[model samples]
Target: MKNWIINQSLDHPGRTVLISLILTFILGSGLRFFKVEDDMMKLLPQNMESRKTWDKVKEEFGNTEMIFIAFGKSGESIYEQTTLTSLWDFTAALEAIPDVEEVISMASMNRMDSEDGFLEINELLPNRELNVIQLEEIKTYLDNHPNVKNRVIGQHGDFLNVIVHPIDGAPNDILAGKLLDEADIYLGAYETHFGGAPYLTGVISELIRNDVMMLVRAGMVVMVLILLLNLRSVPAVGMVLSVIFLSLFAMTGSMGWIRGLTGSDKFLFTLMNTSMPIILLTIANSDGVHVLAKFFKKFRQTGDKREAVQKTMDALMLPIFLTSLTTAIAFLSLIFAPIEVMTGYGVSIAIGITWAWILSSLMLPSLIMMKSWNISSRALTSTSILERFANTIGKVVLQAPRKVLMSGLTIVVVGLAGIFWLNVEVNIQSFFKKGTKIRESLEF
Candidate 1:
């Protein structure tokens, strides 16, 4: 079987290629059923005190979607009757979004509009009564509360508050974008007075979405390119990506299966789906890089692509097997993470890494053998700095056995000692770099 994939790949590249495509399409389709969350509140931590305070404020008087609106006097003063009625209507319109919890401003304050009691505000303001005198008196009151004055006037002294909230149930970028979109339109009607989170959430959603998407996309591209660069053929990349795609599909499909078997509609693992692909890819990276590197190096030395493929597997099988085991073990280490996010990350990545390892060993090699190694591209060429460094290290280990062994032993001892101390000193805050977005948001 080790001899089969590389030795026989030249014989039936077509069939291998076809099967790979079919598998990819199936996997791609399967990934669609994966549901992403839309609730933004998940980004906030419940246990943290500052976040709790922020949440309390939101619960009391903030709309997660529509944040703020303002009214003020300028020129002759906003105390005029016309300005009062106009601002009241806009406030009423904003209260319409079902997800919206609250909106506040001087006009709204005077208007008596309500999320709980809309008809009451309507009666107070009336259909035609412009509450100019009342509004003027309110403007006078605002003068004393200068802290919120900018939260209402202007070129010289206007009101503004930068607001923040997790979009309700906005776990994914698309729906978060929708909430921001709706909020931005509201802001436009109310001008800068109502702006804050509208565009910000949209931008943040796009950034997080695009960043994650880029990582997954770029990883796939890089992995495929790495395969192609080594094997120098379409089929090599095809084989690797096929195996990866299959393993991921099978894993995700298992999720659907689990839900079906349990009769649960809510996918418990959904939160982990976004980064699971990348974690699997990261796990695949170590084995893929090593195996393919050795394969191509052998091919280069032998000048027989078939022999090279054979040598690649023959040389690396034990190491690759060890790598899979270690990778899975490394991921399992995440179980110790204190936070729930880290716990989910660890579990999913552990499964994914194991999946990648299995796919690499089981699927890619099998496909390679079935394909019989006929690809139309140049052979693996020139080693650059990394290969040289790897070679230098390999040579040092091989030539000086006693020294290498002692050094390796010492490193292991140190690593163990380090882990012991690390566990003692470990703090969750450290993994998150100093002043990270999560931290900054918390501080805000």
Candidate 2:
């Protein structure tokens, strides 16, 4: 089979390249027809008891988790009478924000003023003339109470968060940073202390976004460094990156197609976050690297660029095929997971591994055959590592064939037995990392 690939590539490398490209454009484009759902909840199994309970609870109360906000002045600014007066004026303006159900402030509380005495509680005010002394007295009261001194204002995001409940729950989203921005502008504008739901939401939100961005960027940087360490040439690295992007493009396009077909919600984006991409890259690129490395090795061996591709394809084809099959089967096994999101992730990546396998095998060889691949001298310096590893594996398998088989079988049986005996408990809460706002929000 390896000899056949070598011979065929030596004869018509261009044919290989052209046919693969056509396939990529044709069937790859057909993925445009698939429809998938993105709603985060849809990813969870409908059969679960907790999910059922969660859905039931959300239906009645309309959602009490308000978008919180808080603000603090820089100096003794709130101590001044002018600042206190401005806060009263700004509180009146905040009441006009759209969709506000209610606004509570010290000044807005109803005043039962009498000539001899006064009492107060928050209710609609009765129209009456107030003397300057009376308004000043209210200002003094607000200055002393830290609740008002720590102003609570609802801004746009809180308004949105308050409004956009899923009739169940939203995808864990960042409202804290957005709340902080609004609090900063509103509090700074009014020259008053502000503290409430929005401020709290913003602090929690920024922490989440920072962690997500950090994890993703860190993964990319690490992968790039690995590639550079393996193969120093920019073009080689670029080719590898191209394959990665190509797989991603195909996956995203297929996801979009699924969305169109299913009329699914938007939270699917949350499910794909990072783990799925890593798995996709690991499986797909592992095959690609095997084929590419062998191709280069053979090319150096035969001193014929065209023959090198065929030789590489011949040598790497079996391992590549086996790895793809095993990876696909492993992913397909995840259909057994009771979680819907896990099911979606498994299905998406399983399909992606297949596409990556096909494209990487057919297109990469063709691309290499079509163009001259000149590598830098430094990174490829250690084929001995791959070679020695392969050699060691070969020797061990050859030396203890029966022992290896018995050992492997014994281990598998023991592992299976242990797994059967183990008791496990799991839930959606496990998916979120510790110290996350989503958990905090859920608890609240």
Candidate 3:
């Protein structure tokens, strides 16, 4: 069956291209469903004790993430009429946001004071701007009530806090941006700072977005450079890059389709998704190098491109299959992790690596077969840098076999020892480089 497929590809390369294109189109269309999520709880196993407690709390509280805003005026009391009015208006604006369930600030907070020996509950600050006497009275009341004052007003009565409670299932990332934008409107008159889970989620989501774009583009550039310098054949580089691209596209689209079909609320592989393209690129390019090297070596012996491809495919079939299978199995081992996030990571990466192997076997060979033999002929005659490096390594290994074996053993032992000292820490701020907006915002 494998030989027959290779013969078909060699005989009718156009048909192979057409079929690959159709599959690519179908899979690529699913990319639109891909989304980035930053929620940490979703990545934990459903039955994990911490996750269970979080779910129960969320159930009772209807989304426990709060957007906390600190409002303060430099060298002045926040209870001043102008600052109070701005705070009131900002609170109203926040309440008007679609996902916002409640906005608690001095505008909506209740004040309890004794009136004629009976208790009177009223808005902390009246609706209208307060005169000097009223402002003094409010400050005096705040000083007397330590519990309310400490929680709602800052230590010196210079800052007021506005807490925003989002509706259940509200997208915190989107809501964070809305809250920041609304706060910006009132920030001209006061120094406003934002914190809480929603803001942090939004910041981390942005960092992930930036990291994915930068890393994927950079990885491709590095791969192209290495392939061109080592292979010294444009067609070979093109074929390898195309295989990598298609493999990534298929993996991403497949993930999106799965998420959409299952109606999964949480994106289980947020970090894994960001890193998948680079991983696929490395795997796809490694396979491509092997295939192309074998094809060139065979072509040098036979001087016939078609015969060379057939021989290369026949020679590599079992080897590539076993190599890819072992790697895929290694990745699949992650599925056994106690955390669901790692399971998602393992499954997605394993599938992606498998897709890369399949594409390298089929699409890459098809592309090489379709290209002109003139470009590939020179590849066979020339001494590529990679070949020279391999030859040099082989010579060194032969010359000092015992020394090389001892060195390798020492390195492996050191690596094993280092594993005992490894530590795992999740510092969200470390996700972004220093001086970045997200990192600065988090620190501030």
Candidate 4:
């Protein structure tokens, strides 16, 4: 198999390159149809009872997701003329947005007054103003109605809240954007803050988007720096980075294809893109580095790129294959985690790892065969700090085998003893770095 792949790729580098490009283009086109799902419940498995029940409820009642907006003023009662006017206008503006099923606020609340033979429903502040007597009466009534008081009407009438319930299939980000845009127009007189499921989803989705771009770029920069420092060859670094880049493209594009064909949920798209690239890059580069080192060693000895790559493949295929398999299995274990998001993450990441392995195996070798890729032989011969440290350990192990063995046993025992101190706690908020808006909002 090794000899066949080498011959096939080396014998027709142009054809190999053309085929690879065509396949990549076909797979990558799937990205045009990719959808991003921001709902946390969508991450749960479809067969889960909780998910089924939630879906049923949503279908029956529409999306009961509320967008809560709070209004506050400094050193003034919410019943004051300015605050009440702003609140009334804000409530009216929010009610006009499409898909907003209902808006509940102090301005919109119904006050029920029971008479001798009938009941009357009237707006709590019908005129948005009150005389002293009317204020006392309304306050008394609000104090008796615990459900409405303090929730929409503040205890001291110094704050108010508007709850907008959206209809089913409402676009969360667009709705949130509209609400904020309207708030900027209508609630400029008061201090305003937004809280609710829709707002949280919007905020989280934005954070994930920003994190994907930042984290992937940062990971690539760090990977490149490390590769350059260790390999000390521009061609070597380029070959490794190319494999990583192609692997990421293939993994993401294949996910798009899967989603397009099956109409799968987009739960894994952003989350996986945010995390899997860094992990796949590292894993892809590890195998590439090992293969490159072997190839370089052979080439330094014999000065033949094709022969060196072939010999390296023959020597390292089994070991690299086993290493990738075991690493993939370790990631696949997340499928058993209780959370549905973990299961999605596990499947997506495992697929990415497999893709990375395939790309590295085929493309990396093919890339090497396309050129001479000569490098200074002194790279391997130099005694860097790492080499000196490794030599010292070898000397100690050889000269004092019994002592080294005892020390190793002691270290293992100590490590095992410390294992009991480990604790299992999953704080999802901690996943976001401090000083981020999402983390701050969650903490708040």
What does candidate 4's lDDT look like per residue over 1-444, in tens digits? 766766665677667766766776676677776565567676667789988998899888878788888768755776566677788788889888886888988778889989897999988887755666766676778888888787796555666878899877888877888888998998877767677878777666766777778888898898888767666678888888776777667666766776778675642564544676677778888878877767767777777777777788888877888888888889779868765556545665666677666666677777778866545545444433544576798999999999989998999999999989997867767767897655654564
> Least lDDT summed over 10 consecutive residues: which range in candidate 3?
264-273
* lDDT tens digits, residue span 1-444, model 1: 654543434455556456654654554454444444333444444577876887788788654454433334323455555554555554555455454445454444443333765444333234434565765556665576566555544434333232333345433344334444553654443333233444334344444455567887999887766556555567666656655666666556544444445543333343334677676766666665566667656756776765666667777766777877777788668656544344445544565566666556545555555554433335455664557777899999889989999988999998888765655534323433455543332223
* Candidate 1 segments whose C-alpha is farther than 4 A from its true place: 1-33, 38-90, 111-135, 141-157, 160-179, 186-207, 217-275, 300-311, 333-338, 341-343, 370-389, 399-444
In order of listing, the candidates' clash counts read 30, 28, 0, 0
Cα lDDT listed for each candidate = 0.53, 0.55, 0.78, 0.73
**lDDT of candidate model 4 versus the reference:** 0.73
Q: So what's the TM-score on candidate 4?
A: 0.82
Q: What stretches of model 2 exceed 4 Å from their correct place?
A: 1-44, 47-64, 72-178, 188-216, 265-267, 271-273, 373-444
Winner on TM-score (2 vs 3): 3
- What's the lDDT for candidate 1? 0.53
TM-score of each: 0.60, 0.64, 0.88, 0.82
- Better candidate by TM-score, 1 or 3: 3
Task: Tell how far residue 101 is off in model 4, in angstroms.
Answer: 1.5
True-vs-predicted CA distance for residue 247, candidate 1, Å:
4.7
Q: Summarize candidate 3's per-residue lDDT along 72-99 as a digit string, tens digits.
A: 8756777678888888788889989999
Model 3: CA > 4 A from native: 32-35, 71-82, 127-134, 156-158, 188-192, 263-267, 300-302, 375-381, 426-444
lDDT of 2 by residue, 107-147 (tens): 35553334446554543221233445654565455445545
Candidate 2 is scored at a TM of 0.64
